[model samples]
Target: MRHILSGIALAAGLLLGAGAPAVAQNPFEPVVYVNDAAVTRYEVQQRMRFMQVLGAAGTDAAGAEQALIDDRLRDFAARQAGIEVTDEGLQTGLEEFASRAGLGAAEFTAVLERAGIEQQAFRDFVASGVAWRAVVRQRIVPGISVSDAEIQQELTRRIETPVVTRVLLSELIIPAPPGQEDAAMARAREVAGSGPTEAQFAEAARRLSASGSAAAGGRLAWIDLENLPPSLRPVILSLSPGQTSQPLTVPGAVVLFHLRDTQGTLRPGAREQVLDYMTLRLASAAEAAALAARARSCDTLYAEAGGAAAAIQRQTVSQNAIPGLIATQLASLDDDEAAVVNYGGSADLVMLCSRQPALLAEAEAGVATTALADDGVEAAVPDEGALPSRDAVREEIFNRKATAAADAYLAELRADAVIRRP
Candidate 1:
């Protein structure tokens, strides 16, 4: 689900043209009923407009109706659980969410108002999310646990042992404008099947291809065959260098790929490590060092730093994708190990909560080389580091289990609700 706070900014852009005039709204007219609660037509219309503004796929009246129903269900469940978001808490949440777009809450709200969205409507949307989160934490966290054996099993499953094949491919995409799909497919078939030589293909691409690569004669960076759409993978693998694929009709376009080269390599999952970590930026090096010395685990840091506000950030990312300085600092640390680094007048306390080998997708040879270079890992020998700590694996497993439980619980709530549309 899209975060409510970020959705407001996106919806704001959509409301620019909607500020024409306000129609007198009848807030009491029921559009739908979930048990005893009534969802007003005014609210449904507002939600539908908001959906359109967010550019949601297939954002029609039907989808908007269903979404609003779900929101009502969530709101009902939250209220039953006594999950009320205080005014101060809601304000703080709005400010924190606005900070993601580098704007203050007041400034962000002003933009939304200019776009014709009511402040109360935005607040209601955010309140539902905050309340839902609280309910999930209260009802779901108690039953979740991760064992050492389970963590080991998860780590073992993530270590890939497959040999992947990569290809250097050139693409040509012919756009199928409304009512022109057949013509585009015919053109693609002709080009793919002996209609164009290599030089002719390049010329045709420069002239007729609709993709950005048309400017470069349809040349694409190396990509793993597996990375291509599932339907295209088998077709691509069957073609030899200098051969082209049959016209494959995709959404809005018909595509063709000219195989230029292929290579087989054993790429392990060692490069794919998900790191759950947190960074606390303190006012002084002395303060940071003191915190680091006292903190032994992620839980300890959370307890001590709860009130610091904006000075702490938590993230989960592939190890190779983290910033170079932090990645280097964390390279040798075990799970739950803390490191304090002083840079630019602030002291940063970094701790690792968990690490696990990641399930990696196939990539073209050139793409793999670039990724390895970025991670400061040699492509030939990617598995040069020590095994991830058990504690990190356990954390990952715990998170997965908790998420699954929460999803199931929400599904149950929706299924059990009495829903009627009139």
Candidate 2:
């Protein structure tokens, strides 16, 4: 996977049509074949260009060729399975993909065109992905399941062993335009050696970093150390608070990271604690206070909410996952405790029903399941407003198993087919 900083730079470079020169070959000629499907040089060109536009790393000819091959295999399998992406479904997928970059489908296509990518190529690429996911769901999901015993076993294992490390980091990326490495390196060294305050570093980042985080003073959210790239991990681990790293070079960019702080999570690999709570919005502060006074328990509040002009909602979320202000307000409350806050011209009476360590299996499933669920393969779009953090655990686990099954199935298909390259 491309590093986040590199991905950002690549995206910018793609928008500006900056990258290694394109392969100077006949785009219409067939370059490879999967089963009976021909992968034209033109398709590879489009895929490479599109990948570049997406700030993907290693968008070289070989990489593009291999990616096109995998895509061809996936498409062929989807076709054999009778899975097809309707034009409407493809358009929705395009829109959702574009939304990630904060662009509408048309706007994103225009950007691609400006960068010399064809709109049809983008559509074909997305269609393959959508169809392949549907194929996975149909063929593999039925056979996979996560048992309650497995969840309990995972929970027990987590309780017996824990691993925890997290870092607060701010980043700076100086674009190393071709032939400007020395100048960029000199600037990086000067900044790194200056022993600058966090403010000074952030100011430098604002002026020089090419990353999206530059808009936010290059500050990043707290990240688990294990998520850092292997090469970058040691450098980050070595830094003290307020210290910046020596300039490091990545493809097309020179980078420095400021260490804001580092600390362990509450427990090493602890099951994330989830809170089940309800909030009732009332018309007036007096009414809210009256309800709060009358309700000593969450159930009582629920009962009081039935007769009042109240919009009640229940949500389950981990502490850190909650909005900062609300999390802070709820931090001190014990089970069955109530708190009132004013929101949007109304009083919100919140009651805490329960807090417990989420099952380790559920937490793992949430992360794994997100890949399949967010892909919109087997279901309608979920309600984003009411999505619970741990609700998808089982689905995620199922997806993971299904993904493995799908890969095996693909491998069997590949082995049985004759592939050709020219």
Candidate 3:
């Protein structure tokens, strides 16, 4: 089931009239309206207040602007699909938020106030949050699917990737008494050339080596190749298994490494999986709309094959199959609004599908088995555990770039709108 979770409200500054009182709110003067609902000044302020309280660092003006836009988009999507966030949903959200923050709901509010967040304004923020998430899942998630090959490729890449392990040793050098520079060099050369055993090195460091690591026998932990300083990296990389590096000098001291072991260098390949099933064929657009209309209470609408019941069907299909949209927007559905998604047009709608991966060695454990029996011999389904192919990543990149396009498109929408500033 799509969980309708609460999100932070989008904030935008209001255009104030010269003679208007500071508290006056103008609903007609649009700050931003996603699909059509007014995003108010109070909503924006509460979001800002929360940002300040949470010490969130990335709230630049452009980010804030886009957040407001996304807020509207989500709310618009929800409304278009006839999704609504109820009072009980909001209360549950409040409790969830409090629990996440390690506070009681009442205590969380008090904390917000202490952080200078006003109560009612925070409420609007919560409401908008709930509403926007409703929109995202209803409108966007159905079209998203991951493919089996992509999952296999990702698994292969992850499993086959190699890691190089080396034992790194660092030392803090204490310059030998000035006149003893040549003697120090002699000792340094001896240590470098002798290849003393670790215990021998520790003893030599204690008696003759002028380094702080004398106490620890100059031992450093195993180091990943990536974290090595650039100057010593070439030396480290040149060494093979059971090899030690020549002494490398830094500004004041020297660093050394001993190549120990290497692991992983696995090539890419496919993985096996098993999954359960529920597929809802809302026969028509009318049926899709009808399902949306019947949705009411969280469990009630989802109980039998009602408007929101598809999610329950999905859950029954497989406990592991969650709504694929993992971002804040899709998670807020509260089950009811999430279950009845309005997929317009004549295409057969499938809802409440879930999967569980089966052991590869076991018979009949393959991705193709999870494919819709009616979808023909070759239909693609995503393996959630795998990396997407290049096309998929490219598509994701394109979708992310959509907001700018959406903004440009909306500008035309605004030009056509006969909006008046109040």
Candidate 4:
């Protein structure tokens, strides 16, 4: 979940030879192989030092190794997708990273060098992040969707009624086994492009789906709205009862949904309010409390967040799109209200800047949409363009879901990869 702007990306960049006795091994010797690619011992130590530099919480030797392993997976997936980071893009990433620490790129590089970190180590780390982003935004985000129903559902939940809402959906899950990924995607796309009718889709599911429901014509039991994946909630809501979804990529396969029916007494609620909230993670609980006292609004936190821009995040999203934990924190908060939540030794000061109704937030969010960065978990900048509030909401939801799908995609890549430790 660490962004490039992370005070520390990966984890404990343990100082090079901080205390360990000198060993007679080569730093550059290959230690792990991700398919044909090699991971060197030097890279692992460098990553550990990178973690130390960023002051990452709870970082250990094992966490550092796993982080590097994941980096290889991310890099491997990006390459397979034909994604690359240009020199200019890499430089921009470095500049943005340094600016977070209130320094220029060159300055940050000098600081790392002084700490005995190699320049290429930093570059490779940043490049991995930049390239992975391209892989997600270009390869995955386009296929994401957010239902008007999801948005309206959140707004409807405000109705204070006792009515329950549920969906009846049929599934067509196509397995995308290793060495057959492209063929599977092509087939799924073919099915989607043709827009199969309910009967035809059911038959295809029975023939093609790898899910257990295949025997039952790909039919699934009724599922509560809250029970669905956060990404799929809007997707399900957007469909009319009888519609089929574009193929959705899960960890191991592509899935198509046919919403069979809905049985809920629906009623309109209040105007949709897209929330504007900012969260800052400080080093400790005491620092979080200090931030809570000092920053009364999201705008004020920018000054308080110091050079760690990635440590602070701001988002304008549908209430339902927010993660369960953060959403729970924001639930009872008022405008400009702040709360301190602890995670181990680390802590976050979450503040609600404004909860404007859709109409009211249109001007701010529509004029410029937030752009994602740093593993696509943080929104660090805004893009210039004109979009309606609803569309902006949709974009935010798509980014959230796309990032999640990107993770699933990465996992699939790992599963299919030939990883080995030498």
Candidate 5:
């Protein structure tokens, strides 16, 4: 594997005899092919070098090849979804990535060039990452939702018992438009009674489900039993592998599930989830729509003054702490998704910035064993445990559900993908 060359200092170390070019490999040779796209030996070497520079020293050529293959799959999924990274967006992405190494894009490219890595290699890598995030946001996230009740139930479970069981499941979520509830239910009943093979269920999900995972065949990875909704736990637990759940009704949709498998393990669960969101009041529905169109994320969505724009406020709180109307509006949304709702005499654009699991975040930081008490008197030690936050538990449960769905979708993509060496 090649070494990652840094600045001018590393440049001299990488130079050949008399500061001439080093020995070359068959750079243009196709080492691997993912579907119609080719992964050249040049690209592999560049990736290996890039990762090494990025501190992934353990990644050899073989590891780089697999990573590039995954990128190919990601790029393909974005293409299938008609997601194109705009030049401006790509540049922003490049700048962001370059900033990680404490260098501007031009400087980073210069360093890579000195190491014989082409500028296009860096662009391709960043572009692929940007496109994949778009795929997840646009094609996978909207379908995964955590309910208020589920949040409370998760808190109760975490306090009384840590979740030990995780289940593999597939889903079919059919939208029941205001006037078409009966029709949607009828269709859902037919699907549920079909005794679908996993393949058949996947096909149905692709064709009939309204979820983002519809593109991935309604598949979901192993999710903890504690993370599931309290009401649905019994129904899901009742199923055996290959058994489909009866059509279950949720707000605005009728859904069914297929149990694939189950497992058990001890894992620390979430105690609370904090939400950071912003809302902009608008004078008219049309105004809200215009603003929503311009809004990509909280960072990008600016609050304007006067006319159509009215008031903007940012708040952070647990899910259950949000007002009923605002919470309901946020339920169907993913991070960065904006929903326009009638709040009194005007329209409100509610945008979610982030929803985080407090306990999980602490755990990752090596501080889950300690936290603030409810009275604000002092922090709790390991034996006393952290203060209970239903919101954090809610956040954890929701994140796991979302992650499982994404994994299932990606698995389908990998399975259908054609990988080869020629």
Candidate 6:
């Protein structure tokens, strides 16, 4: 399996246009160009090492196959959209990765180095992430869909099985001297409400709270309300934003909460969406210009061919069922229109056109079962449920359903794409 993974990696290396570089194989040169861009063996090795450390270090014959497929898809994407990764974007990515892993930039690099990964390779990995995500967003996400019933179902589930909403809070818990518990409690009392508003709580925490987060303000993060200390949950949730709770006795000292906000871990009913679209192909700059020209003569073509020249290829897709070319193009369109367009670009020219109304109706009908399910969520609502407004729920359902449909449509596209691997 590892060997298979390595083979796939090797194929990816080739697809990236990796080659040996140098005047006489200049030892100082660490990079080589694939296509019009430069990449280095150093970069690949570093990325591989990072992958290993990140536990993403696996490959098999199937892995190799997937890599080849991805490479071809990426090539098609690059040519279609003229996508390029930028240095600033790469830097931003590195910073984000480090932040997510709870490390400073320098510390993150140090860890990578300790793990035998090089900086350049890490950069390549970041760049690859940016490119791949772009492709997914561009070619896949737009055509995904969800239905109203899905949102309702999710909401209903949440109502039925509510998770305790807890505020995860941090305080500068100053330990009192053995004999000074009373004094500390007195001080805690003076500081509770008058000390900090939720927005100002961090500042107060830094200045007066006795804990580790003094430097970063009191950031409690996500805490489950049910799991909180018995005396803490009510105080935390009842206080409005910017309000502070009364000091309460705990094992060590007086504790209080500066309410930040409230969040619910509720899963409602099934959600759904309606998707509509049309697609066209423009393979080059000439083709884009010719679309207008062809449009002018469209009447003649319609008379001779029994349909517009554009009629040769058109797609109307639901949230769950979409054609691939249209799916890729839909990535650029709005939620309501992503699946209902013709999008093709000549090597340099790309155009996405809207779908016909009839096609949209066809898509809606096909995905109606899913859509109705999303819509029926509210009907299942219990009389005792204290839910948000119907409009808000409806909006959520619409967004979810549309997104789901677009996703299913894109999957179909990927499955049917005519990819040729080298």
**lDDT values of the candidates?**
0.69, 0.73, 0.46, 0.71, 0.73, 0.49
Candidate 1 vs 6: which has more lDDT? 1
All candidates: CA RMSD (Å)? 19.2, 17.0, 24.3, 24.7, 21.9, 24.4
Better of 4 and 6 by lDDT: 4
TM-score of 1: 0.48
Q: For residue 205, give model 3's deviation from the true position in Å.
A: 36
Given candidate 3, what's the lDDT at residue 293? 56
Q: lDDT tens string, model 2, 127-183?
A: 888988888888877778899655555444445443337899999999878656545
What TM-score does each of the candidates earn?
A: 0.48, 0.51, 0.35, 0.43, 0.41, 0.31
* Model 6 CA lDDT for position 149: 57
- Tens-place lDDT per residue, model 1, 344-391, is 687788888887655422221123322355678666644422234567
- Sum up the clashes in candidate 5: 6
**What ranges in model 1 sit over 4 Å off?**
1-28, 52-58, 161-395
Query: In candidate 5, how many Å is residue 399 off?
Result: 4.2
Q: How would you encode candidate 5's per-residue C-alpha lDDT over 1-422 as one tens digit per residue?
A: 11122222333323321222254767788998898799998778778656534434323578788888888998999999999999999999988877766778888888777756678988998999899889988977788788876875564455444333789999999996655554665577677767898999999999999988898899987898879987778888778889988766666777889998887533444545667888887777777877888788887776433343335788877777898888888877898888888755788888888776655445434664654599865563454234445567767887798778777877888899888888
- Name the regions of candidate 4 deviating beyond 4 angstroms: 1-21, 155-392
Q: Write the per-residue lDDT of candidate 4 for residues 65-132, one digit (tens) a residue.
A: 77777788889878888888899999999998778777798988877776567899889989989988
Whichever of 2 and 5 has more TM-score, that candidate is 2
